[model samples]
Structure formats: structure tokens, C-alpha cells
Target: MAPYEVLYGRKCLTPLYWTELSEKQIHGVALVRETEEKVKVIRDCLKAASDRQKPYAYLKRKEIEFQIGAKVFLKVSPWKKILRFGRKGKLSPRFIGSYEVIERIGPVAYRLALPTELERIHDVCFMCRCCDDIVLIIHM
Candidate 1:
């Protein structure tokens, strides 16, 4: 079993290593058990793997070989208010439009040349490619 597997609550052990734990500190306390030394080894391996995992920001920057005119989509994230909070009625728009890559400012942000109609709401929406062909558009 991988180290992080135990952290994620996977059936990653022999019956001997399994033990009931309180819901609050379920995984945390389970990891401290003296008997599960082997499991601890697995946990260590998993932790190493997790630590080695690239950060979201770094991963997003690797998405595209940006060209001056490559077509790409912009993603909008839902907003939540800290005070007087209620769900915004409008469903968050997905794949709003395919805008051309006008210029690359930094790894994650780009200068996009958008339509004049969308100028009021958006002219330059910063993007981060979190996954393959998927850019998370950050409102600036």
C-alpha cells in the first residue's frame, strides 16, 4: 500500500493492520498506532510520493505551448460571500468562449484579446491550466 493511500482512507492494509478509529481523528490517530509499523512504512512511502507531487500552480503552467493565436477556453469559478451569504442564482458559466492568446505575461497569466461586447465584464481574464486543456480563469 502506498503511504498516502492510508491518508485517503483506502483499503490498503491486511486485516491485522486495520483498526477502528474515532471519526474526528480517524486517520491521524490510526497512523500513530505502534502495531502498524509496516503500515507506517507504507505511510512514509505515500507521504514521500505526495511531497514529490507538483504543486497546482506549477502544474497549471505546463498546459500549453502558447502561441499568438492558439484557441483556448476560459473557466469561471463560483463566488461565495463571507457575509449575508447565499448561492448566486446564475450557474457558473463553463467554457465561456475560446479566446486567442494575444500575449504571455507570466507562466499562468496571459494577455487575451477579447470581443468588445465582453469588455465590460472581461477584457483580460488571467488563466491557469490546472489540467490538460483546462484553464482555470481567475477574475482580476
Candidate 2:
């Protein structure tokens, strides 16, 4: 069942679709036929969107994995508003670990064996990209 149905204990009643449209209202055909045409148009739009998104998403979707004993680089960045990495933008390292992945919390989160210096910092790996993932590839 849908979330709306589960929440309200019944199917949702929207103002636009409060009552069913009869066949004789606008189109000469039955209501089902008219709705079917609308559904086809919506499906076509959704398919077009999916087709465009597939290649774009797949380009950045790296299948990166590490075994229990393997080490993965933990990202080093400013977490709080007051924290600063200084004005040297060109020299700062983006990721700071070969910190061991002690436990896999979930698909995205990992429990890293952080250094004593970073003990107060959270062990969870933030998956979102700091900058845009897209890169311009000039093929010869």
C-alpha cells in the first residue's frame, strides 16, 4: 500500500480527482481511454528523463569497495563553520586516510579506525562529492 493510504487508513482523496470523470464529459470515448492516453504521454516523458539520466549517473557511479583488512582514504575537510584549512587551497590534501575500515555500518557509511588526533571527529564517511562530479573529456 502507498504511504498516504497507510497514514490515513484509506486511499487519498485529492481535490482534482475528487470525482471520476465520465465518458460524456469532454472526449467522446470512455474515461479509461482518455486517461490511458494521458498515462501514455506521462510514461513517454518519464522514459525520456530516465534515458537522459542513465548515462550521466553511470559516469560518476564508481563501484569502489574495500575488504575488512583493506585500507581506504578517509576524507579530510572542514566540518564546522569555525574550522579552517588555511588559505593554501593548492596544497591541502582532500582525503587523509589509509585508515582501516573496522566495520561497514551500512552501504554508504563506514567505521574507520581514525587516528588519536582525530578521535573526537566522527568515523562516518560522507559520500557526497565536495565539487561537481562531471569532467570534460576531450577525445582525439
Best by lDDT: 2
lDDT for each residue of candidate 1 in 1-140, tens digit (9 for 90 to 100) = 67768688786656444655445554555466644676688899999887778575467555555666766666544552211133355544544556778887765667777777556545456453334466555342
TM-score of each: 0.37, 0.45
lDDT of 2: 0.61
Candidate 2 lowest-lDDT run of ten = 131-140
RMSD of 2: 12.9
Can you give the lDDT of residue 112 in candidate 1? 73
RMSD (Å) of each candidate, 1 decimal: 12.7, 12.9
Which candidate's TM-score is highest?
A: 2
Which residue segments of model 1 deviate by more than 4 Å? 1-63, 80-92, 128-140
RMSD of 1: 12.7
lDDT of candidate 2 over 11-34, digit per residue (tens): 787533533655546443554576
In model 2, the runs with Cα more than 4 Å from the true position are: 1-51, 78-84, 126-140
